[model samples]
Target: MTSCSPTLEPPSPSRIPAHHVPIIPPPPLPPGPQDLAFSPPLGSLQAPIPPPPPLPPSPPAMGTAPPHVFGLEKSQLLKEALEKAGPVPKGREDVKRLLKLRKDRFRSDLCWILFCADLPSLIQEGPQCGLVALWMAGTLLSPPSGIPLERLVQVATERGYTAQGEMFSVADMGRLAQETLDCQTELLCGGLGGPNRDLVLQHLVTGHPLLIPYDEDFNHEPCQRKGHKAHWAVSAGVLLGVQSVPSLGYTEDPELPGLFHPVPGIPCQPPLLPEEGSPGAVYLLSKQGKSWHYQLWDYNQVRDSNLQLTDFSPSRATDGRAYVVPAGGVQAGLCGQALLLRPRVSSH
Candidate 1:
């Protein structure tokens, strides 16, 4: 068998076609005298191609809806919640007007210091919902000293207001609010369920937040099933019956004007039923880690939650003075309990 060499000789010139013959080009160099002229081999160096000019930065999308907090869009939830709620009621319109006025005055008015977005979400590390709520209220109502939650816990523990993971008395909470917040506390009896519903509305409408101690479980006893404790939340404001709350957790939809989707949740209350009428939902802001949970609850939901306190027997009741009419005797423990916090110095 004949073996072929790996390196073969070039093709014979006579056998190659004339057009196929290789052409050796002259060196690429400028004309010059023989002694001074020099040129590198043709393929040695190359001129680097400059990258195409970077595309102009894209303009930000106008009217972009905020990212959704949940799978559903804000408009979908709002439509579903209000389909039967009828047209926006007059009371709701009035509330909207007042809230708008407050929004307009937010920068100039100290009374409107706490907007729905302004509520800091301080989570409870242990059975210290009350203390956390107190901290939120204290820090917001008074000048900001940047007091941490640990400090509030230490304060409450020293005062004997908290022990064994239980806030045993509502009266103690009132006193604690007065002492820690340096603000007068008015315990109100009505909570959208009783006769003082209008008053509670007034408190919230005027930008006063309520520290409500409720079952937190609503009718669902998730805590009892898990052997946990009760809860407290700050009621920031009541939502307009027909308006979209974008701040708490909504963004305007770019595709459709005046439409929104849930950024996780709405800033204010969830949508309400037609029968519930206008000014239907309340914004309940609670801590969940670093951020907060925004819930829009129907008036009855908040009412029933607050009223559940009536069944809670307080460990002690040193202060029984409630501003509104008491359904039970004044001595009744934790009945229709709510703390309306006003700044110590008038926000004139």
Candidate 2:
């Protein structure tokens, strides 16, 4: 009674077309027997994709730089550091020649040693500034006695440098020198100051190589330079002005015609610098007799080096007057803190 059947409205012209709208349904597989006899069904247990040949056992974690076969590449690096300082020092051409001639031998020396691409990006792993320096010095001073860096890492882990796989604490390194490197080592510079003049010479005189830390600020360090991202280099030589150093002369009798007498019981003293050039900047040597001054290496050469000869020593008194002299030519002064590393025959 309420209403007749409601009229249905026809669809609008926009609603539907004469052609049917199709859906993208996947196609069905062809039937069984043919598939089994012909090519196996796409669903059959195909060779399990072989898991990509096990991915070559994966590489040692990320921060690692590829292992380099032996060689200092020092000559090339030194040339780069010095040529930037100023007119290359007197015999740089010779050093370059040595580098070229000894290049093969140097590589042989660094060959088989493991090195990681240490960078600031790896800050979480700990600063590599000290590590790189040690790497160079240990290789140089110890001569044929260094473990691959990866192995060093493992040994450090066993020795309790367990904070991060690639990180070694100062103590960790000291022990590493003892346990793994089989040599004695000491931290020469800590915090923002350079080491004492005579101390560096003493070590060099005794055949110890120094590890110098550098940074852009050249202020607080152990890591970070503009391009350096915390850098280090091996201090291999001391540019002493004179060959032999004499001890102080003291006289019990002022009336004696001659200069003061020598003490009887003194052991030979390692030459302490004259007040003249108190702490002469160390004359860095990568190779002997090449006259490389204050040579340093940077793994990341991120910024141009600022190596002007900054006098580390101002000179001590020959008698009374201080004897200060230019330490080295245009020192790259990559040093913020310095460390002394000496290799003694391992009791082990």
Candidate 3:
């Protein structure tokens, strides 16, 4: 017991004098602008701001060739073929000849034509293999001779039809011409590999049939073929004229071109014609005869003063006049025991 107590007492002296150092409170912060009494600096509490997020990645650069050139090739080919064909001829013979020539020579001539055509440099630099066959067919028949092939190609290519700035080679032209001829023969013989017969016919009938001059300097030469100019002119005129027709709810004075004149009133029921063998609103020309005649369907309704006859005939229609029958109306007889009918209005 004495030993334990003694040891405890000594411990006090050895372990005693454990001094505690007091943590002094930080000095009062100076007043900030917002704080009336004592406030820390405005931004003191916030950690240093992080740098802003990195900007978005830039867009990838575009390749040299513009995207539209692909479709333009076909159009350019068509235009070239038309130019080579010269103006459309009146009879089928010229058209057939032009078509045959194009089928024979286009490929061989394309490279030179494109060079002269003046296509864009980008296209010229790119591979022109895709357009070879089309170019050949277009150029062989329609050679652009006087014009710089490069410039024509450039213009055609601007519409995205040809390679930009590419030069033509005679070898390439020859190969292309051969290929185009083969293809044309196949097409003419109804051997084109797809359901394209109808499409080809439609194109031949409606599309531009002239060959453009490749030589920029060459004044347009009329195709040596006959009737080409007249046919081309007529077709162009018809197209231009058709655009002038008025739609429903619009009345056009035939004298005024292209402008729409509003029709204030509703359309009246159209007049009717009489029986085929009898007198009616109009008369039909016999197949054996050269001309047509008009008859009064309702002689009472239409006075003699209102009737005016014209010599015009529908160019495309067979046997010309078509008739509409009017129910619950009086029927009359035409002269010469002929069929009486109403005059047919032209759509265009």
Candidate 4:
């Protein structure tokens, strides 16, 4: 052991180990990183941007309030849309976009405030749904030139369009529209058990509302056997080609703007849908007995309602001319019958 300690001396330079260097870490990044910037990592939690403030309590449900609730005079584009068949504005931004670009894409719910009368007053005395529908259609097409509902009902009675205050025959209604409203009427036969999809889209986009007949009772669930009571209504707006993911028998029909709540007596369903390429929802200005308002029905609801009216006959019309009793008169129901009404163009 003594001998080994004595021999411990400075050996060769290669044998000696290298000197250790003290390592120092880099300085921290600046508070804001002035020179370099980076966005937050993907899928990171971020402060949410707030949503829009809610609208005023739904504007008293369509038919509940006075005529001023429709607010037609507030927007000139709305006036032009209903009166001149001008391009409809989808939303607030769409209004500006249409005004500036003048290019339209039909991808939203179209609405026209064509009917703003007191419903209770109009249909209180009798079964005048057909006349009310015609009145709405005439007003939509003719603007300030449309005749009064009373006058229209009187004329329909005198002309035999209605019997015992009810209108049942689709053909007779078409004739009535032509003669009374001075409308160029085109009757579309739903040969395929529903409304003609092409015809519905074509007329609706051109500001021509359809006078359609459907069983009012069939709209709600718990199907009843009240033998179809054909109720007439006017389609004020139509949402066609609703964008939906073509999956296994499902749809995602976008809702119309505004807080549309369900009324007590109206039929409220989970937005009944049709096939992908079929007719979409229809917003009908309908009057059923005491309840008069806008009803939302999918294409199938309208079709089913139309189909249910197969056994419906006029309440009082005995003559063949008063009902759907033509030469080969067998198909009696107003199955998918729609009247395309256009104002008679004056040839000055």
Candidate 5:
């Protein structure tokens, strides 16, 4: 059996042994300062040896310079930063925010309405009474008693009087007066640049009233006799007092001369009187091309000797119906003719 079986050595161990590699250490350098003296001087070398002095600092290489030190431009960097900051909001909300910021910083709400001496007095007296008086008479009336200068403004706003409504606030009144003065200034300087400019300015500055005459009597009181006459006239006068007169620019139209006709810088139309028996007639004064018309009433006549003037109320004659009064009404004293108009002053 031993002979037949070939000598088969046991199978060698399956795994090979790992080898350990040796690591060689680096050689040590000679001593520095202490060994320097032991070495031969550089001049004693075979070739003419040069002495080694101190080494200069290393210069910066061209491409190796630091980013900031290379003087890199900032435009690209700034663009990148702005891109990261993102987009901004726009339109109404942005505008509102900006307005609020400005208002808070400036304290604009605390600003007082600016007024000249004349304008302040006028505003203090209330628009219906004071401004109306000024427009009619070129001055304040009777020193403006019984009216709180401040209350007038409060009442005006309460009555729905507003600049937007064409009814002015105290501030608006001041602005208008200032504007009037400015216009006068332009006139004085002949800024209009026409031959008649000076003349026109002169008339305005002189306070010449614009007037137009009408043949019809809008006032009906002439038919009434005695004590009864003043009653209707007074009511009519009171109504006229509170009514708003149209601006010259609005009422001046040549097409409807019966209603509106421009006569130079000013125009006046005669007041029409209602017939004695007429049941409160209604007359319309309309400017051509305009949708609006003014309503005037002729009610009962009331008389005060002070009321005789065209500026007084009850308008010369009355027939218990409303009729249009010419612009600015009749002047205060024309040929001993009274204004015949009386304005009613009351809180709305």
Candidate 6:
């Protein structure tokens, strides 16, 4: 089991200064294949090649990751998508390939770190939300630890969690995760009912994986008032439209990168995101575009990655089950049961 949910509270007095912050948009999708010779430390997004018409659905990935969709477009595209909206999954096979890449990884060497993020059920005895998020954060900011699971144990031990021994503590979880990512974190208690999906996309575009709290029922389980259990997963990345760099300002909105414009309807009250640090803190993927595309590290597991997720709108109540959360009523906001953990910028 992964991290379970905690009883949620109201919003904090201090909110993330999202309104003032400019949502950095991803650059135009890369035109064509970039020379493998050049590396993208914080530069361009490399996309996959298209398959010839007819035989297959998704072309095989050339390397470690799958085909690219948006290249650098993460937010501008998402915002545009919010306006027009796209198709959600209808059934099993449909959900599997809906917006996910054929493979688990992205072409960027930076994302190679994601491969080390495997939080199998065998690793820990019980639910381990903090440990799961910690491993992901560590892989995101630092080089891949040659032995990831072992590395997680080592870090937990150093944090004095080994002494605690398989105990589930939110404090320990947050602290360990904070230390691993070399960043700070804040709890987004309110507005979680509607993670906006747009805001979640914006956060992902900023390269901070959102540690979200999901009531177990959302994960295809039956629940009673007393049987409220929470689960956590990191929103790592997406599989959308991406490609090789063809030219300047060429972007798309299908997968998350598109032309930039004012994103309407961002709520400040009961705001649900963390503060954006000073300008230079978020690495810019393009200097010329309206906004920058912060790189993300996607763990790519079924639980963490949305590759096989059928938990969104339209599919909210599938298989003849009712998951309708009444707005501001008794079962509102997933019963007012969600939280957003935005990664803070590290002082060190």
* lDDT of candidate 6 over 218-325, digit per residue (tens): 422222222134334444443222223223332233333321111224321121222232111111110001111112222212222221222333432253543323
Alpha carbon deviation, residue 266, candidate 6 (Å): 23
The model with the greater lDDT, 1 or 4, is: 4
> Higher lDDT: candidate 3 or 6?
6
Residue-level error in angstroms, candidate 4, position 339: 0.7
* N/CA/C clash count, model 4: 0
Against the true structure, candidate 3 reaches a TM-score of 0.16
- Looking at candidate 6, what is the lDDT of residue 159? 49
| Candidate 5 global CA lDDT score | 0.24
Give each model a TM-score.
0.48, 0.37, 0.16, 0.49, 0.16, 0.35
The lDDT for every candidate, in the order shown, is 0.45, 0.35, 0.22, 0.46, 0.24, 0.32
In candidate 6, position 122 carries an lDDT of 14
Which order, best to worst by TM-score?
4, 1, 2, 6, 3, 5
Judged by whole-model lDDT over C-alpha atoms, candidate 6 comes out at 0.32
Q: How many clashing pairs does model 2 include?
A: 42
Q: 66-91 in candidate 4: lDDT tens per residue?
A: 22112234545534433343222222
lDDT of 3 by residue, 178-207 (tens): 333222211121111123323222222222
> Candidate 3: worst 10 consecutive residues by lDDT?
230-239
Top candidate (TM-score): 4
How well is each residue in 186-259 modelled by candidate 5, as lDDT tens digits?
Answer: 11111112332233222322323111111112332122232122211111111111112244432422321212
Worst window of 10 by summed lDDT in candidate 1:
63-72
Looking at model 4, which ten-residue stretch has the lowest summed lDDT? Answer: 1-10
| Prediction RMSDs, each to the true structure | 30.0, 29.6, 40.4, 35.4, 44.4, 20.6
